[model samples]
Target: MGQLSRLAGTVRPGGRTARVRAAVLEATQDELVEHGFHGLTMDQVAARAGVGKTTVYRRWGSRAGLVVDLMNELANQSMPHADTGGIEGDLRANALSVLGALTDGRLGATFQAVVAAATCDEQAAEALRAFHLRRLEEWVGVVDLAVKRGELPEGTHAAEMIRAISAPLYYRLVVTREPVTPAVAERSVVRTLAAARAGAFVEPVE
Candidate 1:
């Protein structure tokens, strides 16, 4: 099996253990946001979590391991897509949800900083990719529903449509350094839905 499979298998199953793991992961995310990846230390995480260094080390093994777990936890906690009964309404809800996440006072700056650091760190990049994949899966469900409802063209790539909806928001957050307001998110969803309706994402014949 692959590394991820192995990691999945190793995750502790149950109540108290799961709670402790979650607490530690939350502490790690806060530390990483306050002090970049390079500056983050296991000792600091233990201190913030009110746990001992030995507990953290025994549980996670290293800083990278802790970060990987944190990313996985975040992915698991990501909001699910809304089924609003129409492509436009679904996309609108989806876009607004993303905007809310990006602009959330506690998670926004942390996510932005982590994404920037991921560009230079292989481990961070992998974790970030996993988080995005989870998010894409959520959005794809909405697109799939639209296809079933005859709102989208046949063979439309829901994953690609999700990327289109999010691209501008990420660009604004990372490049343009602008706020990901509801207006911006609504416009993106409208444009992407319009294009998808127009067959902009139709797959070419093999």
Candidate 2:
């Protein structure tokens, strides 16, 4: 699966520890995509990974612990903010990246599983929160650069602007159950950019 490769951390020759971690994470993602978080179990993950149950438990402690590490790995692999010499292009690039991940079969299912789990699981929710927070921080750089270039307001909240670009796409993906297409992603960037240019994202002076 395309998602499996992304979840598999980099490997090194003779790196047994890295290999074990990669196997466990790959198995964890496969289980999440097929069975979801509610159905996920440490034993199943261990069995699927071909690692000992004791090794799984000793390393992850519990299903939530596994999810936390998995989320962190995914976050670390996220692409850095695009710089296309203009905010619009960068925002469109960002929006399309979100659309691509949410539309991907295995990756999308994995995220949906985590999101559903987060609805009632505090640990899952925290993991999801941290994952998005890291992504948001990474992409906010484009907005900050745009402001410095006089393309956006002087005090535009970079993080807020970046969030605005992705919010509508996510709403369609999770809330409205609507199709998240390239057109939709483009519209989000356009609307968010227009608002940012109008100072809608500017932080209020206290």
Candidate 3:
């Protein structure tokens, strides 16, 4: 992994540095939504951001770098894990949040572009995997709280529980080519919660 990709999440920005990053990311997202990943170009992002091409190249290194940083920004902007004092409520919150992101015109388009790129590009695949993993890791805490509260099995895999809550929705959105709506999101929450409560997500002893 490149240094920028490894440190994308930890690097803090401020003042002029923050402004440049914000501009570049905005431009990157716009290009992605408008033209898809294959159409995206570092020069175009630079032009859109009103920054020099050399600066963009020197800073971002490549289109994949821009994408990783943009995804990092989105993950940072996503709301923190919900704590509704109950497992069902927390899972519902997670589902609704996923629905909102998938339904948002701009954000949804950007994700679709990245998904498409991932089909043929290894770097894009890595970027997508890392982005979704971050999201999963963030929300898995809710499941941890659920387990602690005895709403789930003591050994439930929190990450898989989190993944379960969103997998059906994404399948509908990206696989079955169906609408990803509030109804779909709610269904995912219910089904996953049932399976989770049944110990389906419990880790098997080795």
Candidate 4:
């Protein structure tokens, strides 16, 4: 991991830094949702976080930098994947957990804001991509276990299967503007699992 520089004397120890960081992230989320990427300003974050503008600027170099930090924080706080001792149960749990998060008004809105910003900002795009890659790796681990247990075919590409399961939920969020309900998640898991079981996701022989 790269060394992260602290805001020299700006963030006090003993949870002060954590508290302030949380406040700043919450304020950033609010600003992104309300004013969008272009309108995100240090002044707005400072006002919302109840901190000095210099404090915000000193800690995060720019609005994009602040957003990158906020994205990292959100990804870190996401729920851990389920391990139910079975492939189907684990997948169902995983899907529902993600669906629940997507349905959360705050998280959902925040995600949309970031997605919008990523479209126009290279730094935001890199951060978003990194976040997705981390999520993909987590989901793939569960599928790998399933393949080892013969629940899925040997050589099944876990990452591809996981993406197949999640793509629809994201589509609903970004395109259809529809709610990503538990039912939707359940169906996605069921369909993807069915396809995997049918060898649709198995790696082709050379």
TM-score of each candidate structure, all chains considered together: 0.88, 0.95, 0.91, 0.88
lDDT by candidate, in order shown: 0.77, 0.86, 0.83, 0.79
TM-score, structure 3 vs. true: 0.91
Against the true structure, whose TM-score is highest?
Answer: 2
Q: Give a tens-digit lDDT track for model 2, residues 34-100.
A: 9999999999999998999999999999999999989888887777778799998999889888888
Lowest-sum lDDT 10-residue window in model 1? 1-10
Name the lDDT value of residue 2 in candidate 1.
6
Off by over 4 Å in 3: 1-13
Question: Quick one: how many clashes does candidate 1 have?
Answer: 0
Where is model 1 more than 4 Å wrong at Cα? Answer: 1-15
Q: Identify the superior model by lDDT, candidate 2 or candidate 4.
A: 2
Residue clash pairs of candidate 4: none
Residue 18 lDDT, candidate 2, scale 0-100: 84
